[model samples]
Target chain A: MTSTSTAAVHALAALPQPYLLFLGDTTEAGFAKTAIGLHDWAPEVCVAEWSLPGCPISTGLPTMTPAQARAAGARAMVIGVANGGGVISATWLPALVEALEQGLDLVSGMHQQLGDIPELAAAAERSGRQLINVRVPPRGIPVGNGRKRSGKRVLTVGTDCALGKKYTALALARGLRGIGVDADFRASGQTGILIAGSGIPMDAVVADFSAGAAELLSPDAAEDHWDVIEGQGSLFHPAYAGVSLGLLHGSQPDVFVVCHQPGRQHVLGYPDYPLPSIEDVIDLTVRLGRRTNPAIRCVGVSLNTHGMTEQDAQAACAEISARLGLPTADPMRQDGRFNRLLEACIA
Target chain B: MTSTSTAAVHALAALPQPYLLFLGDTTEAGFAKTAIGLHDWAPEVCVAEWSLPGCPISTGLPTMTPAQARAAGARAMVIGVANGGGVISATWLPALVEALEQGLDLVSGMHQQLGDIPELAAAAERSGRQLINVRVPPRGIPVGNGRKRSGKRVLTVGTDCALGKKYTALALARGLRGIGVDADFRASGQTGILIAGSGIPMDAVVADFSAGAAELLSPDAAEDHWDVIEGQGSLFHPAYAGVSLGLLHGSQPDVFVVCHQPGRQHVLGYPDYPLPSIEDVIDLTVRLGRRTNPAIRCVGVSLNTHGMTEQDAQAACAEISARLGLPTADPMRQDGRFNRLLEACIA
Candidate 1:
């Protein structure tokens, strides 16, 4: 047994890959982002998609059940839909149990353990298959010591949770390397961890060590090297500001990009709490962030403009850039949209 | 085993008592704050103190070994010393094992587990005494929903960890009740939990659920009733700011008291990281706090002037009160000093 004083970061990297993605009955594309993310970022390891009948969402991967996917070289079935509060639905149990029985290890990012369900546990035990909870942080993560590290970091913070922080950071890292800069994408959540083959599941870590874990996520490196760290919950997100604050302080980003969903009004799941403005996010990020990183600055703004017209998305980005005096881009735009942001970050 | 999605708050309240306090071999009084706090606040439960040879600290209770304490009717031995970062010393293990062997249940607030050590676990098992870890939060705590509860809450925030957050909250709650006010002291750490007979172990909570657990701590009280919540960790502290921010947002305190140690230059564990100014702390607390409670305001300052001369402490309080335009008082001062602070909280 390991010392309880330390925590281990067991990543999805060790899970037998070539995965069959379980999308549950989620019809919304947003709920299927994890499966889509894997298809987009780690396509080679994603064998196919599995969803219940009537589920209209798709990652464009071939539809296959657990038995078919396992026969097609899939060794683990990943629960790709992030049900709200990470609570597993009982209806999703049959597919999960089937995956285990079919000789595919059942993996989940849910806070509610997949093995805790009697049927799933029984199936796994009988089949000798594994049940992995990526959201359960391993023991013994030390408390963060607010020491300045040598390497530079850029974190993608947001006005709320899940608005493109992961996508923006992924794009920025890829874009940085494209421009001959030394950069690495640092994932902070389940989907990102699965995509990157490694990362700290920030939301699952013990609260006291959030910063410490972040410190470990992007350790000391060449002064010129950049760790493009993906951010989690927003500074104004009432339910998650604490997690956001800890990540902010721990990441100590030399540069930050604010991620926002233009039409999103209230914090996700918290209808009573309205989302903070981008300006407010920037102001508070700098105000509290100065405790750990006095030189931290916002290099750009990243908007998730998936539902908007091209003209409207461009207008929003242009208007925000003028108002906030920072470069703005929709990370999905493949043109030179991030050039200004890249320049500012490297500067 | 419990559902992993939710967390439980098991307080030190049920530990078999009147107790024997274990002081370890700590030389500093600050390190012995737990033992002293129990002796000071929960005197009825604390019958004696135990420390190894050469330990200079004292809780002013009669010294007793575990055997002697058990003979004197003590049913539990409490680890009352907060060793830096709660790392237990190997030298203290023998005394702990002795306590378990001498017909006493062993309890610890340290992040390190007593049962994890073979000697103590064997002793407890052989003797049929329990090994209780108040630091281990129970299963099935939901994520914070950021819901507004019906209650007037006051939180004692800090400039760093291990100052006066717990004591100040205790005093304010006691003083509020003395003035015919409906109030309760809500503990957030182990010693505070022991003192109050219940609390959420903020440090042990999963990072994502810190705020959610805290919401459960204060709960919904009468609109006029006050939940004087004990704070943990400073927002400026490197190792524990996440815990602090989570508690702050969860408590949603309408009024907060800033607690500081007059001469503390650095964060408790990290000497390289300096403690934040009271002004800086107040600014950030209110700024971040506004997200949870729009009318959040600072009511007063709680200073730990234990190492200061009476004249120095008085002068410091006067200077700070005038500078910040907030009432200031040393919690140890019983000259009706907290009256002004209490009035401001209710105001």
Candidate 2:
């Protein structure tokens, strides 16, 4: 028995690339951002997406079952959707339990703490698997003092709620890394937390410590490194604007990128609150950010053109660039421009 | 034993007015704000003070031992000072234990949770006495949405840290109440929590929840009533400005009172950061506040004149009123003027 376990451990260690099972079960419509972004990024470690039978595949990635995933040398199951209300569906529990039983770690950013659940935790313990909750923020985070830190920070803010702030931040991190720039992704919400392995659910945190969480996530990184902090909600969303301001103050970023979904008309719940013009957003961001950091500046605009025609997306990007006098692009398609703009701003 | 317990209960119930034993052991300079404020407020309910041997009596009230306190109809013990470091001193545990044994309810606003101490919990449980931790903020507080609520909110903001923001707020609440206005005191810190009977320690709450606490503390006050929300920290203090901003946004006050300690040189810890002029503070508060409520205004000034001569205090108040074209007063001394100013502003 000992020899068999040792051989299995050796086999797992010998695998050169770690495989991930992207769990996007029931991912459709409003909950598919994480899956779609992951599919677009095409991280080399991710092997295949998983979903329940009859569920629409939003990411268009290859599919696999828990057994198939384990057989393919998958080490972890990554939750790739912010499901409605952040609750893990009962259909996913069997898969999560089976994966744990097969020694595959369970990774999630759901507000419903997976590790705190009894059956999944017991299964993981029995199989020596780990449960990682990305949205569990660091404890005892101090209230942000707004003191200057050592490293450069690049925050991705947005024109409206869920307009690809996390995607822009992640893409920027990747582009900077491609250019040999030492950069790290600082996740600010649930989906970003799963993608980056750790983050604070800014909305879940107590109001006073919203900025404190942002500060803790992107603390004094080394002088040569860049901390790309993910943005949450938006300044226009009345329900979540307080969070946006707290994060802006806490991060104290020297430079920022504004993310927007072109042609979006109004904030989600309150139709009366129309989306601000691109220039208005830029001005508001700078004005709000500089209250805490006087030297703050906007370097670029990240456009989320997922449902738009290529021609329309290009037109929108051009218009934003011309009006705001800032470099603008779809970060996933034109990641290098975003990186270059950030480089210029920080330099 | 049953007869003796019954008689004791009757004796306690029959007392015309309950007495309070004020605890201020080890009280010294830099740790007497609570005692001093409480002394000045001079609540008729409190009967005597308790302090360690050789410690100066900052409140100038009568003194008593734990046993003597109970004999004098003291039904509760109030912690009367914000001790250094917020930790409960070991020297006071004996006194606390004796008081609990004597069946006196314990009230404190210290960060070191009184109920969490095993000995104190056991004693209180055994004697059927209550332990109140006033700074324990409400749980599951959602992020402030900056939505309009019924009634008027008047927040007290300051030019720098520890400038009597809480004292001014409490005094304003009292003055408004004295004029038969339905006004409530909302506490934002430990000392204020102790005085008001409940409040969130703004600094201890997570960043996102700071404003939420403010919102929760003064929720849906009646149309005829005014909620005087206590402010925390200062807009210019680097160490805690985020909290101040969060509270300001959360309260969504229709008007504000700018609290200043005239002639103060700088922010408490960072000497290089000088205190802003009164005009600068008022402008900053209004500008920051209006982001949430566009019609928000600063209608008055509350000055802390602790060390100033009476003539100097009057001159300072007069200068502020003349410069800002607003009512101004040392809330403790010129109580009626403060009340009238608040009435006029809300009216």
- lDDT per residue for candidate 1 within B1-347, as digits (tens), equals 11111123354235567889998888899888778888888898888999999998898999998889999999889888886667778998888888888899877777777767777777877888787777777556668878889989999999888888889999999889989999999888888877776777888888888888888888888988999999998888876888888888888989899999898898887888888899988998998888789999998999999979999999988999999999999978955556888888898
Cα lDDT tens digits, model 2, A281-347, are: 7777787677567889888888999988878887888888888788888975674556556566567
What lDDT is reached at residue A301 by model 1?
Answer: 95
Give the least accurate 10-residue stretch of model 1 chain A, judged by summed lDDT. A1-10
For model 1, the superposed segments whose C-alpha errors exceed 4 Å read A1-32, A47-58, A62-77, A81-107, A112-132, B1-33, B47-77, B81-106, B114-131
User: Residue B117 of candidate 2: its Cα lDDT?
Assistant: 79
Q: What is the RMSD, in Å, between candidate 1 and the native fold over all Cα?
A: 4.6
Binned by DockQ into CAPRI classes (incorrect, acceptable, medium, high), candidate 2 is acceptable
DockQ, structure candidate 2:
0.30
Query: Lowest summed-lDDT stretch of 10 residues in model 2 chain A?
Result: A7-16
Give the C-alpha miss distance for residue B279 in model 1, angstroms: 1.3
